[model samples]
Target: MQATQADFTVLFRLLSGVVVLPLAELARAFPDEKLDSDAEDAWQSWLERFAARVSAEAREPELRVAEMKAANPKYIPRNWILFEAYDAAERGDYAPIHGLLAMLSRPYDEQPEMEDAYFRQSPSWARSTGGLAFMS
Candidate 1:
């Protein structure tokens, strides 16, 4: 049987079941990382329970991935676009910025006109600038 023939639901559930340890590790690893004070306080108040929940969610990889993807994205306005817009702004041009905003508003769709440029795979500059291909 090929991998796809496997029960994906069961596979994902099993994956989630195994996420518990990592989540605990992550929480411990990031304890000093600054976060929203109120949210952090609330989270810490129930850290143990929440950690268990995180592990449970991880057990269901498909659901976990879906949840994150829903909250995140697979594309974003490239930094080059932002730079172009900023440059245009400095020169009193707004078309680039306007076009970029429009593209951002419809990120999922492949705008053929932009395929040659903005639609290409994210360039290295993005990573260098700490911009991910996927926006949150």
Candidate 2:
């Protein structure tokens, strides 16, 4: 529930070129009220610094993206997922539990089928709900 839409969007952008995150999209996701210019500049500078460090290593762009993707998981076992699994288990239907287990097995892979169900930011319902955060 702590995850924001912008956070997931940023991760997607980073997994792409990382240098191509649209300034307008970022500004919309994190408006001036949410993030001041100083904070924005600081983060922009941080990305630039990180890019410079990566440039120093001179790795292939594709290889760098692969490494980033390998290091960063596209999916995580969200609390709501576990809840759904457990609820299904309580109903004596084990398919959801099996699916959850299968999804968890490859947290970093781009399982596109599971994207809508699991990959994005926490749902609005989940944000106000407590205990969902208990799931890793």
Which one is best on TM-score? Answer: 2
User: How would you encode candidate 2's per-residue C-alpha lDDT over 31-87 as one tens digit per residue?
Assistant: 121455666676577556766776787677778777777777777777777888898
Which regions of candidate 1 are displaced past 4 Å?
A: 1-75, 122-136
The residue pairs found clashing in candidate 1 are 15-59, 16-58, 16-59, 16-60, 17-59
lDDT at position 21, candidate 2: 49
- Which segments of model 2 are wrong by more than 4 Å? 1-19, 23-57, 133-136
Write candidate 1's Cα lDDT for 17-50 as tens digits: 3333332222312213234555455545554674
Candidate 2 residue 71 C-alpha distance from true site, Å? 0.7
The TM-score of candidate 2 is: 0.64
Model 1 has a clash total of: 5
Query: What are the TM-scores, per candidate, against the unseen true structure?
Result: 0.37, 0.64
- RMSD in angstroms, all models? 14.1, 4.9
lDDT score, candidate 2: 0.62
Q: For candidate 1, which ten residues in a row score worst on lDDT?
A: 1-10
